[model samples]
Target: MKYPILCCISLLGSLTAFTSSATTCPEILSSKQRLLNSTENIELCEAFQGKTLLVVNTASQCGYTSQFEELEELYQTYKDKGFTVIGFPSNDFRQDRGSEEQSAKVCYLDYGVTFPMMARSSLTGSSANPVFTQIQSQAGVKPKWNFYKFLINKQGKVVATFPSSTSPVSSTLKNAIEQQL
Candidate 1:
């Protein structure tokens, strides 16, 4: 009888986890990503379902690296309005080199980034991370350089792709973001 009860408990726990995960992410978005500054992997649906996102490929040592400040400004400005900016530190362009800790310090300590940032991962080519692959597949664009941004709507669809030169404060980007909000 005790064995049967234990099995039932295990099954119930599994079902609960499955149900929550299923409801957390929209079907259009790939839900898996490794969090920055840590060893944990996350399901995006679980963490950011129904939110507008500015997904950016970032580098710590690039000419565009200072965009982190504007990105953080955007994040702070619209976070309460269901907007978030997720940064992915990528070394595909050979701009960022250091431990994850060092990279994170640049984002958190130097730039004051408060939004979620993922671990270092490729953002272009065949070896790109799954999330980037999905974004590129749907959006029909790829990052030509660091700080390329994709704006995703609340329904998890890519609404626009902003090139590296587009400032976070650009009225065009801001208008696109405001529309989603």
Candidate 2:
């Protein structure tokens, strides 16, 4: 009887260890992405796991370009609470200046955006980046214009989407983000 009890305890310990070591990557964050103006790439799940994300498709020359300031403010406010904003420069609407360097300059030097900005990528049609593809599939919507935002919960689920016309400082957007956090 004593030997049987010891064997059962050992099996339970092994199961616990296996369970703890097996961390599953969420589907939405399972792809790799390169940062703006850099050759380095990072897995989204590895970098952003368990954090609420506000993913935006940006264009430097658009009428809504000034929204970057408001977006930065939103990021600064909730960043400490496990929230982050990610920008993806896209020329799907012919608004970008068409170079990674220019995009980087617009984001870093011009707007002072500290959040992660990805390299220029297609945001619509068959050439969309993997991340945007996932977002579209999960949220059932694609960005119709630059500055379109998708709010994702900590679980990697999209909770809300804001059009390019929606200000980052709008009460509706803020409330949605607060709920997720």
Using lDDT, give the best candidate's number: 2
- Looking at model 1, residue 130 earns an lDDT score of 75
Q: Which candidate tops TM-score?
A: 2
| Model 2: ten consecutive residues of lowest lDDT | 18-27
Tens-digit lDDT track of model 1 for 1-181 = 9999999999999999998867757654556778888989887776778899999999999999999999999999999999999999999889989888989999999998889999999876777887788887888888999999999999888999999999999999999999999
Off by over 4 Å in 2: 1-23
lDDT of 2 at 16: 91
| TM-score per model over all chains | 0.84, 0.88
Q: Give residue 31's error in model 1 in angstroms.
A: 2.9
Q: Whole-model lDDT, candidate 1?
A: 0.89
| Model 1 RMSD, rounded to 1 decimal | 5.0
For candidate 2, write residues 53-138 as lDDT tens digits: 99999999999999999999999999999999999999889999767898788888999999999889997678889889889899
Task: Sum up the clashes in candidate 2.
Answer: 0
